[model samples]
Target: MTIQQRKSYLIQVGAFLSQFKSSGIEKRLDLACNDPFFDQMLEQIDMAVHYNGWFTRENVLFSLEEWDKALSEENLEKWLKSYNFQEESKTVGLVMAGNVPLVGFHDFISVLLSGHKVLVKLSSNDKKLLPILANYLVSINPEFSDKIEFTDGRMNNFDAIIATGSNNTARYFEYYFRNKPSIIRKNRNSVAILTGNETQEELKLLAEDIFRYFGLGCRNVSKLYVPQDYNFDSFFNAVLPWAHLMDHAKYANNYDYNKAVYLMSEFKLLDNGFLILKEDPGFGSPIATLFYERYTNKDALLETLQAERENLQCVVSQDLMESEVSYGATQHPKLWEYADNVDTLTFLQNL
Candidate 1:
C-alpha cells in the first residue's frame, strides 16, 4: 500500500485504541470493524495484565490513550510532512522492548509510514496488544496483512533492522547486525533538574513524571538533580497524591525490598512509605527508589548533563535548558519525539 493508505490505517487503529481508556471503555457506533475485534481487544488487555504483572490496566490504557492522542490527523501530518518517501518497499526487522506497554510502537509505525514492510519480533512481556491491532488493521484493509509479520524465534530475511535492548544486548545487536544498516538502542534513563524555586504545582506535576508507569518507562524520571541543601519536605509533600501506588503489590514488594537493602547497608534514605530517595550519582535507579545528586552550580550541572546526554532518554525541567521536556510531559511525548535522539523514519528512509 501507499504511504497515505498506511497512515489512514494507522489513524483507524488509533481510533480503535482511543475507545479503551483509563476512565472506561466506550465503544462508539461509528468505529469500523467493532464486531469481534472490540471484544477481542479487551480480552488482549486482560491477558496482557495476566501475563505480565507490570502491565496493569491503568498503565496499558495510559499507553493506549497516549497513542490515540498521537495518531491524530494533525499530529501525523505535522510529523511526516517533511519526510520524502519515494523508495521501494523493503522488509525492516524490528526487535521491540517491553519495558512499558507498546514501547516500540514508534519504530513500528515509522517503518510503515516510510513505505516499508515490517518484520517484528515481539517482546515476550508485550506480545499480545500489537498483534491484535495489526489484525484490526488487516480487517480494515487486507493490504496490511502483507505488510506486517511477527516472529517468535530468530528474525531474518529483512533488508535492515532496528533493535531496542539494554546496553549489553545493544552490543550483541550491533555485532549481529554489523553487515546491515541498523539502529541499536541502549539503556537510557530520564532525569529531572529541580530548582528550589519550583512551585508546588510544578513539583506535583513532576510527581507524575516520576510515578507514571510505576517508573518503568525510559522517559520516567528515575533521577533528580536538585540544588544543594534542598529540603525534601516540600518535594515529598507535593508528590503525596501518588501515594496510592502503594496499593500495587508488585510496587509495594519492591519498595519493601529496596528499603530493607538500604537500611541493612546503612545508606541514607528519605522514605515516604511508597517511594524512596537515595543520594546517588547514578542515572538508573531501582524500582520504588529515586536517585538524586546535589548540584552547587547551575552552569556546572548543565555541563555535566550535557556530557551525559547520550546516557539520558530525557532531561525534564522548567525552561532550564533549550531541549528540556516540561515537568510532567516526559511520558507524554509528541509523535516526532524520537527515542534516543535517533530519527527512526529517517533511518528507514535512508535504508
Candidate 2:
C-alpha cells in the first residue's frame, strides 16, 4: 500500500474510535469493571499483581487529537525511518506489554505502515481488546488483514524481533536473540519533576500522567524529583479530582498497605486523597500509594538525571525542557513519542 492508503487506513481507525466517543468509552470501561469476563480476567491479573483502575474509551479519546497531530505523513516517515523499517518486506515479531490497555500498539502500527507483516503475541491480560480492534480495522480495509496475525507460536522464522518485558527478562532476550537484530524494552520507571511553579488545574493534568491506567504504565510517574522548597499543598489541591479512585476496592487495598508501611517503617508520608507523596526511597512499578523523591539543586539534579537516562524511559515533568518532559502535560503525549525507547520499525530495517 502507498502512503495515501496508509493515511486512509488511519482515518478508518479513527472513525471506529469516534463512534465510541459518542457511545461513551468511559461508561463501557466502568461497566467492564463489573463485566463477568473482564472481572474474571482482572481477578487473575490481580492475584499476582496489584489491581489498578481501567482506561475508559474517553481516556482513549482524551489524547487522540495530539496523538493524531503526532502522526502526520512527514512525521510518520521520519519516525518510520528512525526505526529503519523503510522499503522492507520482512515479518516482524512483537511481544507486547499488557501494562495498560493497548499500551505498546505503536510498535505494531509502525510495522504495518512501513509495509511489513506482523506476528503479535498478545498479553493474556489484554487479549480481548486488541482482537476486537483488529477485527474492526480489517472490516474497514480487509486487504491489510493479511499483514497482521495474533500468534502464540514461537517467532523463530521472523527476520527481526521487538519485545517488552521485565528487566530480568531483558538479559535472557539479549543472550538468546542477540544473534539477530532486535529492540528489547526492559522494565523502566518514569519520574515527574515539579518546580512548584504551576496552578492547581495544571498539576491536576499532570496527575493524569501518573494516575491514568491506575499508574500501571511505564510512562506513569512513580517517583517525583522535585525542588526542596516545593509546596506540598499545591500538589495535593491539584490531584483532588481523582480522589474517587480510592473507592475501587482493589486499588484501595494497595493504598491501605502502603500507608501502613509509611507509618511503621518511618518513611516520610505525603497523602492527599488517592495520590501519595512520600520521601519514600524508590520504586520501578508504581503502587496505589508511594511516590518517591529526594531534594536537589535543579542544575545538579538534571545532570544527575542525565547520567541515569539509560535506565529511564521517558520523564513527565516540565523541568527537563532539553529532555522530553513537558510541564502541565504529564498525561498528554504527542504522537510518535515511542515509549520504552525501542522503535521496532527502525530495528527491522537495520536487520
Candidate 3:
C-alpha cells in the first residue's frame, strides 16, 4: 500500500470513529460487553471514565481525533511512507496482553498499516475486544483482510515477533524469539512523586492514577514518592469520596484477598477498598495495590529513580521535569509508541 492508500484507510477509520455514536464501533463496544470474555474489560473502561469521572464525552471525542490525526496522511506520509511496502509480506507474530484496554493494539495497528501479516495470540483475559475492532477494519476494506490473522499456537512461520508480558514471560520470549527478529515487552512499574502541595482536586485526579483498571496496568501508579513528613490521611480523605467503587465485587475481591494474605503473613500493608496502602516498597506492578514512600529531597529521589531507570517505563508523579516518563499519562499511549521505548513505525522503517 502506498501513502495515499494508507491515508484513505485511516480517513475511513477516522470518519467511523469521529461519528462513533452513529458508527458500528460504539454499538460494537455495547455488544462486546455481552461476551463473557470481555465483560470485565468493558466494565473497567466504562467505570474508569465514570467512577473517577475521567472519561467525559469530550475525552471520548478527543481520543478519536487523536487516533485519527496520529494515523493521518500528513503524519503517515512522514511517519509511515518509508515504512510502507508494495509486495513485501512478513509474518509478524504478536503476543498481546490484557493488562489494560487494548494494551497491545499498537502491534496490530503497525502490522496492518505496514502491509504485513499478523499471527496475534490474544490474551485469554482480553480476547473479544481486539477481534471486534479487527472486524471493523476488515469490513472497511476486505482486501486488507488477507493482511492480518490471529493465532494462539506456535509462531514458527513468523518472520518477526512482538510479545507483551511480564518479566518472567520475557525470559521465555527471549528463548522463543531468539531465532527471529522480535521486540519483547518486560514488566515495568510506574511511579509518582508528590510535593504534597497539590490542590484537593489534583489529589482527587491522582487517585484515578491508582484506581483505574484496578491498578492492573503497567502505566497505573504503583508507588508514590512523597516529601518527608507528609500527611497520608489528607490524601486518603481526598479520595474517600470514591469509596463506593470499593463495593465493586471484582475490585473488592482483590482487595480482600490481598488484605487477608497480608494479615496472615503480616506483610505490613494498608487498606482502602481496591488499593492497599504501603509506606514504602514498589510492588512488581500496581495491580490492586498502591504504595508510597516519603522523600523530602527531589534531587535525591531523582538520582535513585534514574539509577533504576532500566526497569521503569513511566513516572506518574507531578511534572518534575526530571523523570523520563510523564505522570498520570500511564494510560493514554499514542499510536506510534509501543510499550516502554519501542517505536513501531520506526522499527518497521529500519527493518
Quick one: best lDDT, which candidate? 1
Q: Local distance difference test, per candidate?
A: 0.90, 0.65, 0.65
| lDDT tens readout by residue for model 1, 190-243 | 999998989998999999999998999899999999899899899999999999
Q: Please provide TM-scores, in order, for all candidate models, with all chains considered together.
A: 0.98, 0.82, 0.80
lDDT of 1 at 215: 95
- Candidates 2 and 3: which is better by lDDT? 3
RMSD to the true structure for each prediction, in A, is 1.0, 5.9, 6.0
In model 1, state the lDDT of residue 63: 93
The number of residue pairs in model 3 that clash at the backbone is 2
lDDT of 2 at 41: 30
> Residue 146 error for model 2, in Å?
2.5
Which TM-score value belongs to model 3?
Answer: 0.80
N/CA/C clash count, model 1? 0
Clashing pairs in 1: none
lDDT, candidate 3, 72-113, per-residue tens:
556556655455455457878899986654566668877777
Which is better, 1 or 3, measured by TM-score?
Answer: 1
